[model samples]
Target chain A: MTTIAPAVSGRRRTKSLGSLEMGRPGFAWAIPATLFFGLFAIVPLILVAVLSFTRWDGLSSPELVGFENWSALLDDPIMIKSLWLSLLLTVLGVVIQTPLSVLLGVWAAGHQRNRAILSAIYFIPLLLSATAVSVLWRALLDPNFGIPAQASWLFGNGNLFGKQATAIGVLAFVSTWQFTPFHTLIYQGAARAIPRVLYQAAEIDGASTVRQFWSITLPQLRNSMITSMILMVVGGLTTFDTVLILTQGGPGTDTMISAYYMYEKGFRNFEFGAASAIALVLVVVATLVSLVVVRASGYDKMRSTLEGM
Target chain B: MKTRFTRTVTGTAVLALGLSLSACGSSDSGGTGASPAGEESGQFHVLVYGDATNKVEKQIVDTFNKTSKVKAVLDTIPGADYQQKLQTIINTDQAPDVFFNWGGGSIAPFVRANLLLPLDDYIAKDPGLKSNFLPSVFNSASVNGKAYGVPMRGTQPVMLFNNKKVLADAGVTPPTTWDELIAAVQKLKAKGVTPIALGGGDQWPTLMWFEYAYDRIAGPELFQKALDGDKQAWAGEDSKKALTMLKQLIDTGAFGDKFDSVKFTDQGSPTLLANGKAGFELMGSWEYATIQDFNLKFAKNDLGYTNFPSIAGGKGDPNNVVGNTNNFYSVLKKTKTPKAVGEFLKLMYSDEFVKASLAIGNLPTTTNTEKFLDAADNPDYLKYQFNLVKQAPSFQLSWDQAYPPSGIEPIHRAVQQFFSGQIDADGFIQAMQALPAA
Candidate 1:
């Protein structure tokens, strides 16, 4: 009995009560949450997945066609084009918005005078709904009486950048304008959380202001940067409302995103099976990219490191 | 711990309760269910595509509700989104008992799906209906000899609506021929006035120009033959001439430089004529109602409607007009109380409905509707409609609604591209020729 008590006590010494107790309430809370998520998100996703394997035109009973819809998506040229466009937009949006947002956040954070006013001004577009933004940009980009055309005329460039490039640029620019503010707020919060001493330490090491930003400020904002980039990628990939309202995937499908194409296929053409397949492909790609982003940012490593400290 | 558990349980219960309530609400309101009591008890739910604020549709609906045995409930969706919404409802089997539908290609999908109740039986039983409607209008609703809808109005292609004051100021009467029209437009152009009010922003209106020009050059037979897949070239010599003439008008700034930015339904085109900024507008008979809605006034004689004049030495006839049966009403196949729907249809085609419709400048499809056409006694302007229908040798459906969806939407896009100069005359012809033959 004495030998067994010593062995059990030795095991108990290594396993802390705190570690076991920490997640008990979480498990208790997770039951209803899991039920809710199962009912809404998981169940709907499964239904869509099952539907993707079927040959149904939204009106009739769905018949399982195995991998036919997936194969059809692989062969569809328009679907391929739309996928490429969505990817390009997502990459461009993230590439442009991240650094711009970080810079804006850093600038806005350091400046005390009129900080609130500047923040509000920067956030106005974020406050406007997507529909309103589309309408406003439509007027601003109108070839006849628009500000862009007027500027082009004043400067003697036949167009702002020529017709095709002009439309693409406008779409990318509007997307960035609408989303950058959200990222700015995220980065600003992250940047504000970093102790002032880190920048001071960088300065003491003979680093310039830009060097300090690259080293201290940016590195500290790693998690937020990853978060913002993921959001931007997902948002850009799923963009429909702005494109539908503004261009309707037109001036010749130059700005047709995957989401817009799905909407057209599902609603306009009533090819729900094809749309579901496209949606599944989008989800898989987004999920894989999100995993890579989270891993690369070393979020798991950071949490462990913090725990160790 | 007990309090936390109680709070969690209560929250879950509330959420569950909410979900159940919402589910109930959606099932009752959104899903396919029995018609409302009013609809079951001889009331008709009439869904229309037009301006809800327009007194014309309201007056007709109100009169029908008051005077007829069937009560009317009118739900007006905006013209642009109406078709899409109607299609969704029809597909879901939540369609209203009676709803407005465009007569030709637009209704073909519903007809083919068996979503609409064929009116052949109803028409046969009610002999008066067979005689009441014009042959052309009746034919528009018939597909392979079975009627699926009842044409309620008449439609025509863009005609020249001249602003008498603007033309007089430019020292010109309404042009009688294409050359005279061009000369008048040129005269108006020289005076720094817009020659024509063109709403190119709405791609359909822009396409109407192409259709009308083609009809005027190639005639209806060749055009129908082209749609029927008998012709290999849309850019035939006649089509080329039409495109050249259209391009000439475009170059002459006949449509204002900024016409692409204007919305079609905002009266941007008609405003040019009404405000005396333009001499003529290429529009349909429906423009009379639009003009009246906008509070634009002109003497009945001053507002002249003329066909797009013949191309000089063209193979087509000068007097031929592009026409179709206008919006029609269809009963749902799933209606439990079809008698109520039939009664509503009766009221819709009744004498009072015809008179009210005509009073608002809409030409009724009913034969002898001309008797109710009081253009002289009333402020309504339907003289052009009466003249066009009476004088036409044959009427062709509007290109947008003339063929099946597979054939129609692509043509609309092609016409817009043609107008936008993306495709040349030959290219336009080749592209249209490639459409699957009807």
Candidate 2:
């Protein structure tokens, strides 16, 4: 009892000491970080925000015209369409990818051979650089002499990229194809950490594989599922490289998204000021969408748990 | 202590980035500089659009450097990124001494910004430089009655290139009239071949068909007026007729259904012509040399050339040419060595430059080009283009190049939409009228 008293008192002393130092007047440790953030993050953000109100050729002094760039957004049909498409891709990507990843992950966790072969196949896409994937798919989907064209009996006319409906659909399919495996790997990790005794006990009680998965496997994987959904929303909103190389927003601007539109404005048109405006607007939209995703999808629980840890 | 170290590291990185952005921004937004000319003693850099034709440019620059104490250094930017890179660097102190340009609208903005050196004084001292080239070709690079660019390289008149074996297989000769061209499309389509190879994937190649059609039906005056701010000209009866003909060709399946997927930049369209899968391709004269380099047998035994067909009773002369009349070399206002650069301009009209350019498949527009036609790689092909250029009553510059940079993409998009049946005649006219005029 005497030994325990000293240990408790020592821990209390350290706690009090930490609280005492928190009230120090100087910001010696914080000053460098604050200044660095002010210089890089704050300064660049303000520059972009200010430039959005101007009209400038990239090579000349910007001419200020307040709210003009913002006003132009209303008349710009392509910009509006791009935003809607980005949101659609975000929602659809999560809905499609989550189920596929969860099923594959549950199935692969059963045995060593199943895990090895399925993991190898699923991980192959993540290994490829975005550029190589885009070009390879372009050739494979070529309407003249490619795999789809040769097997036209299955893929009507092999001109899937020509029609607007099919092109956007195919774009979503390609995105899901490349990204579902990552989510699967996350779910599999979570599955491994689950106690084997829980499953064995459920099986002895005559619970089927599907019933055990529904009651035990799913409840255990809730945190990983939420994490993956948030990541997917962020990634889907910013899909630039794959789209740029594949269609180039073409067959007459059918597949253009916000990122590509921003590029076209800045690089192709040399209208840097307007492009900056588009970028800031995109950032704001993404933030709001992400907030809604987190609140609606139980991400607060995971974040709070992390904070507590 | 650990927190302090991390803060310092981040602070340094931020400071570095801020300094970098400030430095790059000044040059880009510099507008114009106060200083104009530089000393004319040392070597001057000349930037060219890098492509297959750069071989000829290198030889000419080498010959000039060998003779003059003030030497010229050559730099090439890959063809795709040339324009954007030039715009970025031209405002900086690192601006090229002289640069390749399409003249007219391509250099108009630079000229307006006063970034170009007007060559009028140089022309006054050297009469031969102005007089040696054809007036039409020389006038291509002129703005407001003052010459801004010297005729460098060669003329590039767009011509109807064909596969001789493909045409023979279909039992059709090269068409000389609009009706005959339509008939040949029908014959070629019935023979199970893609009648014409079009690189619609690259937007500029799609514009050539429109250039020839508009020039043949409405004449050069129509586009000249349209360019001069008569937007109503786009809605005129003659313009409607030309658009109708293009629609007819598309409907008859002259270009295959998959042309929108093929590209000239990647050699896809050329491959079709070379492999005898297509009967015809309307392309720049450079196609002859390109086909030769890629597939020697096709260039030797099967490549064919002819003028764009005349539209009967139309407003144009049958011999009117359309395409890049010639590419030019314009002087930068910030050149470190102006006098030496002017001396180098004289070499463009020199026999050595002409011969080297002709040894490749370039059709030099010099008045003395006639003397060296026999030295051309394919002399017969050279004679055909030479006669075509010499006899042209008017050479309509490709609309995209002739129009300002701002208008190029809109023009390309409208044409693509029309050809794909996305827009009608009135829709196209509205799009063209919406374009800002020079």
Candidate 3:
């Protein structure tokens, strides 16, 4: 009864504060932030949405074309193929980066040997801008004379960037190489925060290294895993600079993913109306995909883990 | 605690906005001119495409600034990004009063949008302006018979740049006919050298082969027909024959296995030409200067350039030329100092300008340029190009630059695909046929 009385009073005081928020100084202070976001973010988003239904060449005023751009974009073969490739890339990115980062993070965080040096080596890719990394990879993968191309004769002498399969594969590998370090750092931080005393308790219980990781480390790092997965999916959807520099969607549109296709259409083709439609479509898909990832990664399970801890 | 957290968040957000606001405040608009064109303003901006010739442009601007009341400020956007940046800023507040352009269909959109000033009025004030330049070159800068641009730089004509020593080693002279070219290709291949160094990765370099081959195949009329929206012209026999001839070269392995990965802009093809690896590279006349900068001895002793070979049965005159006519300076309609810009352009044809251009290996388009040919870095090369252009029955501008700006990418893509064998001749024809009618 004593505990229930304090909880009930606490709830009453929170309700009162919520009701009085309109008059509060904090709420007044938040107005500026709200207004800034509304002006910069919301307005542009609405403008793009409106433009998706118009025919605009950017030189003149936009003419409303009613659902023509959306229908045309949906009917485009290149857009369809590019959209599929985008999804495939997103799936590949999440599937590849998640497990590898978790493994690396756990190994570095849990192991006492050379952890600092090893993590730093893994972080070198994160230090390079996407443009630099892309140009480096392009030179390194030059079929006739690149060091990697010459050395990889053990595979075959087929041109890497010119062939369909190898082009996408090399680009994906380059993207993964650059971004995995980011996810690893997240997991490393999460692993470090899992309470060393719990690990000590498991050691006393005669738990093997792998067993301890499976039991405690993965569970404790659930939120970080979900956060990293959502981030990577969004990033993969928006991937541009690296692919643009490396390929420009060459070898006959084999590597043209959605964002790049949208760019080609808007900037190169002067079809901003069609590009706007593509941008809105990508946003919707990214949001839905993020929601799905959050659910599948067990957002409820993560909340329960937090509560139990 | 919650109140303290809100305070920190607010402080950080305010700090971030303040920082961004300050960052945006950089790039101050140069001194103001609130009056109309010809009204006295202290300064005006002139944007030029950045290249090896930037020093020459800078000298001209400096000369203009020394005595003129309205000083000219030079802004240069680097080579590859120039066209893209110009597009974004052309309709904006930051657009230069006078800007560089390729003229012709390249500036067709600007003219159509009423954003470019017709220079007829300025030309009337000084008849020497139009009369001082070559009729052919100057006419290219006109849109619908009204001058919108002034020829400001050298002419660019595509030529077959070669390594003389490599051809000599194979016992093959620079081919004057298509049959001889095939024979030379065969001889060169037997001697273990790539017959042609094609930069398929850059794509535009590959389009040179198409331009030359098409001109040699069906003459300039067919290309003009296609550009004028004759879909039937693309399906014509000459177009098909042109594609077939191009395919034959690709099938012969004249470019070798790795040509698709070699890029011209990154010195791949040029390196092949300067060394003994490739016998020939069909490139602009700029190839001489570019190679001379790196390997002077090879450029001076072994670099050989000649006209694109004539096809035996072709309807085109053997003297027809193809490439860029030249670069031009166009005035924006909103310029507040048209008279000043016109005055500045008068220097384009001045004897001082011709001497400065020749010193840099550029072949100026001024009719007075012929008299100054001996001043060029290589008199023989300059004379050869000038004669070729002057005697030419027709001069076909490279199709990519001749078409609307938005149309260049697809054309390059189509040419690259044709060279790579990714698409058949029908696909190539369809791509060309799809270009927006000029």
Indicate which candidate wins on lDDT.
3
Which has the better TM-score: candidate 2, or candidate 3? Answer: 3
Please tell me which model should have the higher lDDT, number 1 or number 2.
2
Model 3 lDDT tens row, A62-173: 8999999999987888888888888888888888888999998877776677888988998999999998999888877665557645576553654666667777887788
Candidate 1: clashing pairs of residues: B235-B429
Q: How far does residue A256 in candidate 3 sit from its true spot (Å)?
A: 1.4
Q: Evaluate every candidate with DockQ and list the scores.
A: 0.10, 0.20, 0.20
Candidate 2 lDDT over B1-438, as tens digits, reads 444433443343334434433433453334332222234447888888888888988988898888888888887877465666677677766677888988877887788778899898888999887999888788878876789988888898999998899999999999999899999999999999889998876778999998888888988988989988999899999999999989999999999887777777667788889988899999998898778878988898889999999998788888999989898999987776788898899888888788888886788888888999886778898999989998998877788888877777778778777876778989989989988776
Native-referenced Cα lDDT, model 1: 0.67
Rank by lDDT (best first): 3, 2, 1
How many backbone overlaps does candidate 1 show? Answer: 1
Candidate 1 chain A has its poorest 10 consecutive residues by lDDT at: A300-309
Pairs of colliding residues, candidate 2: none
lDDT of 3 by residue, B1-438 (tens): 444543343333333323322222121222222122223467788888888888889999999999999988888876465665666567777778888888887788778888999988888899988999877778777887799888888999999988999999999999999889888999999998889987778888899998888888899999888877787999999888988888888888888776666777667788888988899999988888778878999999999999999988888888888889899999999888778889998999999898999988888888889998986678999999998888877778888888877788789889878887889999999888888876
The segments of candidate 2 whose C-alpha lies over 4 angstroms from its true place after superposition are: A1-41, A104-111, A114-118, A303-309, B1-41
Of the pair 1 and 3, which is ahead by DockQ? Answer: 3
TM for candidate 3 is: 0.87
Query: Clashing residue pairs, candidate 3?
Result: none
Give the C-alpha interface root-mean-square deviation per candidate: 10.1, 7.3, 7.5
Model 1 docking tier (incorrect/acceptable/medium/high): incorrect
